[model samples]
Target: MRAMAYESYGGSDVLKEMRLPLPKVAPGEVLVKVECAGVNPVDWKIMAGGLDALMDVVHPVVPGWDVAGTVVRLGIDVPEFAEGDEVMAYARKDYVHGGTFAEYVSVPVRALARKPASLGWEQAAGLPLAGLTAYQLLTRLDTGPTDTVLVHGAAGGVGSLGVQIARSLGARVIGTASPHNHERLRGMGCEPVEYGDGLTERVRALAPDGVSVVADFVGGVLDVTLAVLRDGGRHASIADHSVLGSGGQWMWVRPSAADLTELARLADTGALTVPVLRTFPLHELPEAFELSRSGGAAGKIVVRP
Candidate 1:
């Protein structure tokens, strides 16, 4: 199998295509023939050794966690799926290696969910990590029909999903993005506010009495969140750990088949959608990493294998 891997932690320059043996399936796992892999900030961050303090990384690491693919073989005791089943997974293992950036990846059955039939391969591939992050944050905040939710970085991958999920829960959403993306946010059922100077005032103008929930996908907006959140409101951030000291939860997404199934249901019903900003062939992972690092794209970056 041909895969992109980096033997040492570095930048996109370290990623190179190489031929590797197919991974062996372990009990409670399934080997998937990769159709598409989602490129996330974390992928490149890990590549640059940003997560060295938290997670262990193995050498010759394949750096992707989100995948949409078909099962080619099932490991022992995996009774929920058979060969040729279409699935998507947040394929993060207990360690970093054998990831989804390859032609084939072995995913634990616990992390696998049936891919939403309504989404294309690229969209399905984009769903797991970003969608799961958004879903999990909103769930943790206990968002509801009457809540007014504020989403930071609302045009980016996870933030876009956060806006839609908030709306699907019947909450009125206020999303912050650049002027160019405001229309896109409005189309997704959010009241769009431009981020930067006077962000608190802008969000306040929209919510007036203050929002009932805040989901910060972009870091360093703690002050803006505190200014616009109602007294005793719930909040969480995937990017900011400081939230933990301020009565808000700091979240790290956990893989859950049940949650992925709900996201699939939402997609199939037209309540949720994944936007692909660009697609690159598996071999062009270096370019993909460069794009992801530049952070100009408004949607998910996908690599088709």
Candidate 2:
């Protein structure tokens, strides 16, 4: 199989295309022919050795977590899916290696879900990671119609999905972004506020009594969260671990077939949208990594095999 892998940690420059053997499927896994692979900021972050302390790294690592594809074969004792099933998964494992940025990948059944019929291959590939992150964060906070939720970094990949999920649950959403992204956010049912200086004042103007929930996708804004959050309000951060010290929970997204299924249902029902900004062929992963690092765009990036 043809795939991209990095023998050692560095930057996008370390990624190289090569021929590798197909992965051996474990008892609870399935082999998938990769149609598309979703690229997240974490892909580049892992490539740069940013997660060295948290997860063990194996050499010749293929860096990707989100995939949308078809099942070619099932492993022993598997009964949930058939050989021809269309699927998508947040394919994170116990260690870093054997990922979705290849012609094929082996995914555990626990992380796999059927693709939403309403989405294209690229859009479905974009769903597992960012969509699951937003869904898990908001649902854990128990946001509902009676709550006013504030989302930081609302124009980016995860933030945008969060806005839609919160809206689907009947919550009024206030999101932080620049002037250029405000109109687009409004289309997603989010009231947009400019970030940076005076962010607290702007959010307070929208919810003077303080928002009932605050979700921080972008880090370093604890002051704003503390300022605009109501007393005993819910708060969580994916980017800021220091939030643990300030009465807010810090979370990492887990792979769950159930949660991913719910997100797919939302997509099929027209209640959620996966915004894919651009895509690159398998060999052009370095360019995709650079694009994600620059933050020049505000939607998900995907790679085609």
Runs of candidate 2 with Cα error greater than 4 angstroms are: none
Residues forming the 10-long window of minimal summed lDDT in candidate 2 = 291-300
Collision pairs in model 2: none
Could you estimate the TM-score for every candidate?
0.99, 0.99
Per-residue lDDT of candidate 2, residues 155-239 (tens digit):
9899999999999999999999999999999999999999989999999999999999999999999999999999979999999
Candidate no. 2 TM-score: 0.99
Q: What is the lDDT of residue 109 in candidate 1?
A: 89
